[model samples]
Target chain A: MNPTLGMYRPRNTPMHQAPAWFKAVLLVVIAAVFVLFTDPITSVGLMAACVLLLISTGPPLKATAQGLLGIVIIAALSGGFHVWRGEIDRAIDLAADLVGLVALALAVTSSTPMEHMLDLVSRILRPLRRVIPPETMGLMFAITVRAVPEVARMMSESRSAAKARGLDRSFRAVLIPTTTRTVGFALDLGQALHARGIAEEGDNPAPYRRARRVKH
Target chain B: MIEFLDAEFTAPDSGARILEPTTLTLDERRISIIGANGSGKSTLARMINGLATPTSGSVRVDGMDTVKQGAKVRRVVGFLFTEPSSQLIMPTAIEDITLSLRRSIKDRTEREAAAMQILGDIGLADKADVSVNALSGGQRQMLALAGVLAITPRIIVADEPTTLLDLRWRAHVGALLRSLPLQVIEITHDLEAAARAQRTIVVDHGAVVFDGDPAEAVEYYRALMLDRAVGEPAT
Candidate 1:
């Protein structure tokens, strides 16, 4: 099984021990600053600061490098577009903005456990418990976070299944089974929720109605 | 007792009959159901918890109608799916079990404590906070079991729980299932595991063709498969 992206490393460092809310707030502030300030000059400074923060995390070098490689691929295309337009300055600044955000997010993710992140999300959504089950929101986040790597695993399995059947070159052969299995996964999830008593009535915890009541 | 009275299933898309009408009262502590793929055994097992509600008639657990009292029925009838990864919804081990305890325990610390105890039970105490993605197949299955057991259901309906496991994990999970004090209804293709059950039911072409001792049911299933393999219609 593939480890989720930016896995949390259980460490005793100050950043690792920081409250999830604090990191979340910091992430929001970073986002807000980027949104509010459009100047390329400021973005370059922001990028440099994010790099320092990333280094301070003492990340697993391999994962960070792999993450950066992916980031560079996307940023390179966009940066090339800007450079070709004769806006070299804009190209540099845009790359900084892109890399800065990813580095910040990665640093935060590496420091905080997903449980803490979900708890923070649950607490934030507490006020909405009246209209939506707040805890269910956190569960939704957990499921989504868990599903990504699982989806990747399923894709690989589907690919293997296709190769065994000599249909490796056909996209439809892969897509059909992957899609079906994913749908089955979702259906099974509902049954698991119901069996766990998570979908009880008035549980309104996210508008999920229980399985249809059998008529007499 | 988990009872099915005239319970049946019909696939909506193909309008194909998935399970024929059947009636039985099952109260055995360890019951096994065996059938070939697409034989409707999973459908029959799922009916106990309303996962596959009968298209006609009804299923009841301990006098509680599965459909009318589904929430209550579910609270007492734990279900373990074949895929541990699909069932382990939370990000971490303790978190998944804690989520299971959410309805039963309100206090966060207390809930987590109980979850830790459960992980300890399954020997995953050290991995309590580890990402579920990092778990091996056996560990993941154990975690899934911990979540289901955390609910303390009176009866457990397992739908091919060991299908995805390796030889070691199969025996490990099989022993874990057998050791539970609760009543268990397991659907499996493993004849050896089926033989451990007090009773077994064999399903074929969406019908319960045999309901008797596990040994006999296993023989019946083997014969049925042999017939199909030889291009002869099953009797």
Candidate 2:
């Protein structure tokens, strides 16, 4: 199974040095601004700036383009729907806004490691420590992010194995094992955490307080 | 050293017994547990680290109770599964090892440094930052070993670690596991590996049928397989 998502590319760029939470907050704010303010020129400018920032990250242009394929497809489909409804200008503006938002989000993901992003998320969610425990949330986020590429790899392997066995057409054969294994993995991880003393009750204080302390 | 006292395991769902009540002690630096598929051998090996708790009886690692103190037991008992992908929980090789060190090393920078040191020791220093998914089967297995080793457990239990590897890679991994300083308990179907271990235990239907010298254990297992084949008429 190929586990590499190419999202955590190691680089010494300034963007990589910025605290992950700051970048995440900035990306969210930019997205909200793009959605709230609606001039096509403004959207295009923001989109262009995001593209330039992406280019400066030094990931291959082809790789970047390949990663953005889903966004591109969504933009095209939404634009088509808008034109079909006879709102051509609105469609173009929405497409630009969507592309800008996607680009901004991609930049954050590309530059930030999953651990840092989870830490940042945990830090932001620290105030809810009484309700949901920050470390648990951090671990959940990290596991979810980490499991995405792993699950994808397992599914691809299962598909190839099924195809090789001439059972590629059977969705049950592929899906059953994949789902079973993913659940098994989650259980194993929970066990591992318990074994490692990381999940013990009253072991760590609320995550937000820790983050605040780190900030100072 | 590891010891099992009157251990028995029954499948919770089927109510079918896998491992019959059995007891044995292992003090060898390198030991192998050999058995056929569905023979309850892996379950027996897992009991060493509290991975599989016995339905009855107790398992002890150097006197630590497997059931009552499972977390404490696991801290000193490192486990390696047959599939490295199953053991590796992180995205990158270095990160995977570092995750294991989260408890051992509190400082993030020191944790990363120590993980790199372990990677270098395991010959995976060059692939530290590489995504674990891109590694070959053998490389991934080595990375898994590195992750377990990073925790610096006293005893290592590996279940069919080389089953998925080719011959050369199998030998390479076998040699690597053998070279470690920790007490090693490997569960495998590989006779050659069994022969190399300081002691061998041949398990059948969940009980230790033969426990002694590696050569005698091999002979006992071979004969047992032959007896089974003879007992069954041609399909």
Candidate 3:
């Protein structure tokens, strides 16, 4: 039920202070380079660097472990798949690269606060203002980050309620209520948006529209 | 006056008749609807905001037809549910309220300012930027109220808004609702809240069995409950 996007453990580390966009761009670059090249030394070096970065970020070891659970499973599956195909070295390298990239990104999120991350994203997106309003993108990122936990909480509660009612195993029992609750939540959010005047006026394009325009 | 003309509702799941045919007019500003679970009180409140349309009957708010003008009616009738968490859509407190003003203000700065003003009014201005998940129960309810109030609705419909809170928070929220300037229609089991309202309606078996002054309505409901308990004993 932990719906949070990542375990953003708050810390006063240097990595947290670094701009989020910098980390984002770095992650993309590393991922692309790792995938394109087959140098085992370079992959090992990157993996070592990511481990060091994660240790310095100072998140609870337990939280870090839980957050990386998915990445670990994916890495294992890919590595096993490669070994099954008799490409052991290539599999190990691919797994190392993928894990290194994911760990680096997780370190950034774990160290940085959502507000700062949003600010960094907005700053990076500022040039595309003519196409996409930076503020809207910033707000959207903040909301997405915040909603992760909220949605997870909702799903957990729904599951519990379904279990208590002895209908947890029934798809109709679970799906119908969960979907209804989700839609209800969305509508309530929409109403909240309307009340707070977040809706775009007839003349104004949506914030995403601006972002899209900049990309074009 | 709020009026329901031949109100009847069919359950969405089984298509069973839920609300029996009925008609009533409510003129009092503060009214409470009390009923047991599945007694149809919640459905009755939802009908006011057009959240639930009657299968055959018609609901009117100050003479505006709920079925014919559902959207317009919703603008004037702000609905609050017992679970504030479900009602809250936005991640942060101020952002949630700001979202409600999306149509009223074009400028982001102005919208934020207005949202802050509302938070201040609700005594939550300091928590404007805070994530809503971090809020206490009372604070979350206040934020939910702020979200509803940001729209400047004239009527507020709350379905057991305080049922989840502790005794202190329950009283706090009840008092706050009673003090608001908007017309309040509260569906609750809290007898203390019923005492504060100008009028009360007791619903049983999907029908309004009692309607009048709060004192009389409470007495009637208490008697009905007692009779049911005694008569159904050992069954």
Off by over 4 Å in 1: A55-58, A157-180, A205-216, B233-235
lDDT of 2 at A177: 77
lDDT per model vs. reference: 0.84, 0.79, 0.76
Candidate 2 DockQ vs. native: 0.28
Candidate 1 per-residue C-alpha lDDT over B176-212 given as tens digits, one digit per residue, 9 for 90 to 100: 9999999999999899999899999999999999999
Model 3 regions lying over 4 Å from their true place: A1-65, A80-89, A92-216
Q: Quick one: best lDDT, which candidate?
A: 1
Candidate 3 lDDT, B58-158, residue by residue in tens: 88998998766665677788888787875676667877787667556767668889998999987898988666787889889989988888778899999
Docking class of 2: acceptable
**What TM-score would every model get versus the actual structure?**
0.90, 0.88, 0.71
lDDT of 3 by residue, A120-203 (tens): 766787788667666667767766666667666677777888899998787677677777877777676654443333322322
- Per-model interface RMSD values are 2.3, 6.3, 7.2
TM-score of candidate 1 to 2 decimals: 0.90
Q: What residue pairs are clashing in model 2?
A: A2-B133, A3-B133
Clash number for candidate 1: 0
Q: Write the per-residue lDDT of candidate 2 for residues A1-216, one digit (tens) a residue.
A: 223423677898877888887887788888887887777777778888887777666665665687677677898899899999998877877888887776777677778776676567667777776667676777777677678877776688778888999997999778987888788877776655544434344335655334422110
* Candidate 3 positional error at B6, Å: 2.3
Following a full C-alpha superposition, what root-mean-square deviation does model 3 have from the true structure? 6.8
- Which ten residues in a row are the worst by lDDT in model 2 chain B? B83-92
Single out the weakest 10-residue window by summed lDDT for candidate 3 chain B: B99-108
